[model samples]
Target: MAAELYPSSLTTSIPNDPAVTPSSKKSIIQEPDQETEPAPTSTQPNANSSTETGSRWQASHPTLRERNALMFNNEHMADVHFMVGSPGETQRVPAHKYVLAVGSSVFGAMFYGDLAEEQCEIQIPDVEPAAFLTLLKYLYSDQIELEADTVLATLYAAKKYLVLALAKACVAFLETGLEAQNACVLLSQSRLFQEPELSQRCWEVIDAQAELALRSEGFSQIDPPTLETILRRETLNAREAVVFRAVVRWAEAECRRRGLPVSTANRRAVLGKALYLVRIPTMTLQEFADGAAQSDVLTLEETHDVFLWFTAAVKPALEFPAVPRTGLTPLRCHRFQSSAYRSNQWRYRGRCDSIQFAVDRRIFIAGLGLYGSSGGKAEYSVKIELKSQGTTLAQNRTKFLSDGSSSTFSVWFEHPVQVEQDIFYTASAVLDGSELSYFGQEGMTEVQCGKVTFQFQCSSDSTNGTGVQGGQIPELVFYG
Candidate 1:
């Protein structure tokens, strides 16, 4: 009883049922964990697995992580390499982050239109590989970024790659920045490229639009020499000389218009220089005529003499068929047609021979022929006649030389010799070289004896020799 009273403050604890075992209690306390980590399976690794294993950890659950894991771990994830620094360089960068350079911001903008619509976003991956790097560099630098030597290389590559927009943008940059000299250098270098259109556009922008090129001010201008080089490369066309000559004419005209006082001598020298430079047809007819006109400092008569010299230059060209005259015979001696009788034909019958030439609209006849066998040297004349209105073209004279005068004395005749009244015939003895022999054979009379050809004029006034007469109609006969 006393023990029970003393233990009241610390009463001994007792099992409710006294039947529960230690193992059973432990099992009850370790009830199934609500948030236990997943077990390591063949298909799933622990989140805190080894460094190699932990890399497999993904942000989402097992299904999503497993789906993307294979793709994310691909060995070829590295981006494509892109060239940098300059168009022709070996340095490269990742394709995704690159930019391009262009000359004019506007030029690049213009290229945007010609480029395929989808290409505008600058999706470098989708573009042709060749232009990608260069175009990217252009975007970044706003320039071609090619060395002077490598510009041609870049252009060729761009053209070959069908990156026309990039190629044209590069060309525009070069044309705007490079001087005429450098522009010419580029042209000479790219004369045989695949992009003729590009080259031509470059030239128009550089050379034709340049002020010095238009005015052709200096002796050392780049355009002239540049053109010379181009011509040497290709077969120069003849018609192109038209444009070349036009440039020359414009230069000369401008000089004059500006009161530059270009002397005839200086102008000629410049023209000759230009001709030589351009390889134009040497000594053209127009050039010769203009040069000759300017150079001849002489009086009207002296100028006429000079003109005769000029005419001689073109005689072969202007020569017509000896003023065609046919069926003209002295006294209608058809027998003279025989080769045997022709030798002395003039000795028996009369023949008329002379040339009617115009000197300042005045007609004169000078030639010789036998009047008859007995007349001998006494039958010849140096005659002058006035031309009538109806003569449009000159007629040829066909007559043999007289027996007395040497054959070298063959005459070039002109007008028809008719001894009729209203037509006052002027004749003189060939032997005397003197005395006016004026004979008047009139009244329905026809003097049809001629060993030579002659031209007849239809006149209106009878007494006016210098004036035309209007009385009769002359007969003309052509045998052959």
Candidate 2:
């Protein structure tokens, strides 16, 4: 198979074997006069060979990798220069053609194939200097050190060179750090790179925590196609109003990038087809009246159509989809199997029923499932909080009127809290009620809900009858 070169302008065509076709643009750099060491040749010893001879051979000759490492950036035997980076930030990296050829088939075809061009320097304007150096290090020493800031750039360089191992490593690193904060940005890159698995993982986080992901600064930086993809997603868990606001923010950013004034017209122009995917008619009448109408992004006719569709018995034909999105249904992960209403037990006196929990992957904690009053219909004022290391991540004060049943009642937070992997968080709830309620028994230390596995531990703040063994907090409602 013929290996394709990145920056298609760099080469016309090169065979799979050792050869390269240089770019049309070329520059010559004077070669340094330094003593050069010949490339090392390795010979394997016989299986019956003595340990003494093997030790002597090892002492006299360093491994091939060690020699390659020594010649990595050394100009001693370098025959080519790579002019990497952009115009003002260019860097000339000296490298041995044979070593790079041995590591990457693309490099092999570029430097020593049948159609190889005899150029002293190759212009690499698309890749960063740091990322290029990292690639060279991996090729020379079979080792790579990746940092969060430059890993994406390094991945680009790896894919360009057809370095499959390094590219896989970069993808793994990115997947490990995937979260709601960076999922949008990663989703864009993953789609650009044709990495479907990474894109799907990113979509999972974005779908579960749509509001948070859309509100992220990275969402505004996504390309137009990626923005459209998000808008068209039917499983997004955010409300239509939130989606419209995020799209407006993205359009404003895009207008500024294009050096246009931030006007309603400019925003609509930048949004283009993406604006139609917001499902404005699906939004509540109050939401549409308060947000979309005041924004001025929608024209008078479009606004009128939406109002008629909402109130009029005969709905008008609208461009936007009127149906609400099929948002994610959070899974209720019960930590206990049985519940009991003991006499004088499960009484709430405002003491917090807290339990520490952690997950193996990023998930949105929508709410908590608690046992309601078993002594007839009762109303309780509840304060629910999620904390990490004493710092409150999310808190909500609400009221729930239990129907005096054995089923768990879900009390939701104002917004879902994004829980990161392996980070311990405390879910605490204080219920102010006069009735003795059903308490959980036969508590579990771990519960699997869909793809997320939550591990529970006893919290020091649990002063009431709520804990890993027995508690009022029976379940954690979450969307993975």
Candidate 3:
């Protein structure tokens, strides 16, 4: 990867998809009256903009898309010359210094800082031309396509150039794209560039799929700091012994790179810090005796301490054991939403999505979103309950904000509610007052064979009448 000085123009045709995209679908909450915007981090462009864009795209008149294309084609306004890529392989992108400076703090400092007076060519030898072109297009047009193939390079360029918006977009792109294969590679890249969101998503993937990550070819490329963070995280889905085994595996692979025998003292020295990060006292007594004592990495005192603790000869300090994070089940926690708004909705404001767990979990329910229309000057109160078979397991009550919008309603539980396995847990909400007309997904939910979820509707008979099917569930967010 290298480059030299030259002047040329390039096109942004590469892929780098964001988590959300523009859609022509109408907002659940009506347009003019609804002040609630979608989550800012939503990859999808605003529904309002998307609908207008779609209409313009279908019309016989000039559209924003055409205007954007025209700007890309019209290179007469270009000022700066960006020579991107390696020496003989470089592509020159014609850009304005103003665009560059405005898009990036690093470019701003270079072009208008103390060194501003000394004119210099913009040569980016390390950046891929495809990526730089995408950045240029975003700077010039305020839009760029984020896809799987180009996001990494685009992210790298975004971070290096200090393009915060593009950096955020890239993080959103990588969040949905993370998997067993690219988790380690992306984690390393995220760490290097200091993208906290991307780093968090990568770590979550690693945590959720620890065994797969440990087996990944790129696992050995994980940096020490990232590895330490992973080891320290309590939410690692795998058992303690499995983590210890993974640490040993990573250390041995690292030793091989240094051309030393895995059992050598030098190798153990390299693994000392990582080995200490593993909770020795948490391992099975057999695991400590067979695994820890056998690995020459542990010092005699450390090994003795673990042995003493396990044998009750010494009571180790009460350490907060890292509880397994069962919060990674997005499939179980998601609200069933379809773009097509139809009759499959609750006539009443109160509804619930009941889920029977296969295992016990510390359940935290995020407030539900209300569907349907809003009214003028109305008050509403929600009484939420965790019930099983006509018995009240747990309950909470709260008043809706003055705006009467239920879309942003949320209450973080002081303590996560303990839910039991093989038991029916219903998150029932009962609404009072003429606040808002809440909707639900009536018969759209397809409960799989031997599945756990059921729709529970508590109230709505007043307005919707006998038409209410008690089976339709409303939208609710869950984190456990």
Candidate 4:
């Protein structure tokens, strides 16, 4: 069944349809209070502006009292009704046409245009009541209070109503909170809403923390097109095996969504063109033999071709890409401006040189950038440890040879250590060498590396001269 669905000669290229542009539709609007002042002729005020003059001017306006009365208070004043939400869980909200018309041109056209409908109630089955209420609050008071759970829905309502300010605010809020756990989901939403800036930011997080992003529950909820976009990302910092597992998880979720049995054929069917984007040929022979081959998601011929490609002198053309991804390039968060080797300074006698650091977002700490021997060619034994509070998270014992150069040598851990956000972690390194080496001077308290900011402070564990202001521990190498 799976082989009949997917042929071996299937091309990798999948045609992407253009983004759907949301069209403005006419909606029902209730009548306003008899005592309510006439609606303003001008467009909505800039809700994001914080200027004192604008605030004072709006405060002194006579329509403020009318707006307060009409806000969500649908007593005898409402003439239009909106039935929002899905069946069996619908909510009817009463709104004044004048207020909505003043806030949105879409509403104005809907209620007052030449071909406007005189319907008393409108069916809005796609939007949630909470999102609609949020939009109303912004129109009435020029203030927006957004929650994490409803922000995306609110963004949808704002876009539907052509509320540009609220949409921009929602995008900014999402960008501020973006992490590996939610990047995939946000990437899906950003693409859906045509938010290129937010999409780019989400991609940054996904690429840097691809392993964590792919393992998140949100990854399974992403649409097939977003899944294809992620699978085709050559810079994703994850192994091909991890990508395969994530794809399988997404396929399972898709199966459950479609009410189909979670069988191998169903998974393969749901995957379709996305399966070809997984780059199974890039996985090691051991990975293929142990995982993909056993999963039974691929046809027998496809599995055979993979095995032959691994062993044959002349490999056959496979559907999946054979080249490995470029993966993430590590960025160095430098803590100091210059390096100096004073006669009395930079001498290490097994004392730990530690600095406390924290990041605004989650990242993987690959290793540290440290100064080597200042004297002629020499070898030094080094021990590095990372700790949060009093508990140790990661530690490594390694050795490095240094020539009489000013370059800082990279000393890495066995594996990258995942660090949480805004929590202080201490990175300490103790070197066993008699020769005096270069120490970092004029240390910085804050260093901005790409989108992630590294905040440094003096750690109590710094028994050596290393501090945020001076001593050792020149740089932190990490992937965001």
Give the whole-model CA lDDT for all candidates, comma-separated: 0.31, 0.79, 0.53, 0.77
Clashing pairs for predicted structure model 4, backbone only: 30-79, 30-80, 31-79
Model 3 residue 477 CA deviation (Å) reads 15
Off by over 4 Å in 1: 1-150, 188-191, 194-197, 202-229, 232-480
- What number of clashing residue pairs does each candidate have, in the order they appear? 32, 8, 14, 3
Candidate 4 lDDT over 1-480, as tens digits, reads 111111112121111111111112212222344334543222222223334224354555457645453344353456678887756868777778888888898899989988765998988876767777778766765556666666777778898889988888878777766767788888877887889999998887888778888998778877788899999998998889999999999999889877899999999999999999988988999999999998889999999999999999998889988989998889899988988886776788888899999999878898998898788677889999999998988889999888867788889876567787899999999999755898888899999999899999998889987898888779898977
* lDDT tens per residue, model 2, 214-236: 99877887778889899989899
Q: Compared with the true structure, what per-residue lDDT tens digits does model 1 show for residues 1-480?
A: 111100111111111111111111110011142222332212221223344234544443255223223222122221234333333433433422111113333333434445423332222222223334444333322223443333444554455444555566545544433332343434533454435655664354332323322223221222343444533322221223232443455445434544565554444444443433332223344653454334422234533543454456543222111221221222221111111113322221122222121111111232233222222343343232323233322233343323432222323334322121133222221222312222111212222334333323322333222111111111222111
lDDT of 3 by residue, 9-124 (tens): 12212223221111212111112332232212223212244443453444532444334433342344455666788679787666567666876788788788986735444777
| Winner by TM-score | 2
Q: Candidate 2's C-alpha lDDT?
A: 0.79
Best by lDDT: 2
Q: Which of the two candidates, 1 or 2, achieves a greater lDDT against the reference?
A: 2
TM-score of each: 0.22, 0.85, 0.50, 0.76
Instruction: Choose 1 or 3, whichever is better by lDDT.
Output: 3
Candidate 4 versus the native: TM-score? 0.76
- Cα deviation in Å at residue 237, candidate 2? 0.5
User: How does candidate 4 score on lDDT?
Assistant: 0.77
